[model samples]
Target: MAAHTAIARPPLVPEIPLHLATEITPIWQATEAWLGEQGIEPPFWAFAWPGSQALARWVLDEPGLVAGKRVLDFAAGGGLAAIAAARAGAAMAEAAEIDPLAHAATRLNARLNGVTVVEAPGDVVGSPCRWDTILAGDVCYEAPMTNHILPWLRRLAAEGAAVILADPGRAYLPGAGLREVARYAVPVTRELEDREERVVTLFRVLP
Candidate 1:
């Protein structure tokens, strides 16, 4: 995993260092070839996506939101937000990922940032909420994924967990029940997002 990525800080959240791919194509091809599979999902864990970058920035700047709370970074790619929560003095910071590679990357990145992020292995979609705050970044990109996770997230919110979602205008984001909390203009590469920047909106998920 370390062989293909370089240690670098994301553009928006420079305080945290992540193992990121310099280019998308090479990492994508390498992962596919290494797995010996076709039609595999792109390595989302190798890049700090706009949503997670925004979430990390918010948590770092406003530490009280997560300080002394049990925080969960849902669908944590590279564990940017989780690491930030830990740095900001959260009592417990946990990262949940279904992908083993992503879990490994999160552990590696957490260690690099001098933090500890508990790993929530496998699918956690239907699990009962065990966190005080939940940070879900860039999770609504695909329709099927959005459909699969939104209900559980909404349930968590309804159950008194603060479910926060950061979205960079992904197509599958729900049209209602989101109360905007913050917004950020996150810089990105055209090769990945087809744009130089993305305006990421952070919202508190309402049930």
Candidate 2:
């Protein structure tokens, strides 16, 4: 894990550094092997996804969006967005993930950046949200996952929580009820995406 930590830097948000994989394949091989030994899936938390990068960027540039708000980073791999929110002066910032290993990484990454982010445990989607702002990055990459999670996000938005998502042209993102507030050309490895770079759109989920 130390070797993994050695390779990562906040390539997108350099000011707020994070432990991220330098490359896609090699890190996944090593991390997945480690996970296999532990009987779990490969930890995607080890890498900085383009969507998360875009979300973090927007938060830093427009801190007023999160300032004084309670924030929740859904599926907060590596907790980059959550850290950004905390740094942007959100009243509270918290992260939630399904994988225990990912949660461990989130805590470590939070510490690395000198931020206090509470770990929101249990089924994040099933619970009532108390946050004023909720951020989700790169979660629309899969169909089943998108189908299952979007409704919960919509519900949160309807309940007056400010739910937003950053996505890089994924197959499953819905066509309606998303207001694009920002667009970014995010750098990514070819192994993880078809393009070496992607244009990520930061969308505000609306009623």
Quick one: best TM-score, which candidate? 1
Candidate 1 local lDDT, 144-202, one digit each (tens): 99999999999999999999999999999999999999999999999999999999999
Error of 2 at 59 (Å): 0.6
- Number of backbone collisions per candidate: 0, 1
- Model 2, span 1-207: residue lDDT tens: 557665356557777777776665666677768666643455688878888889899999999999999999888888899999999999999998887767788888888888899998766886787999999998887898998898899999999998889999999999999999889998877877877888999999986
Best by lDDT: 1
What TM-score number comes out for model 2?
A: 0.92
Angstrom error at residue 176, model 1: 0.7
Model 2 ranges off by over 4 Å: 32-40
TM-score of 1: 0.98
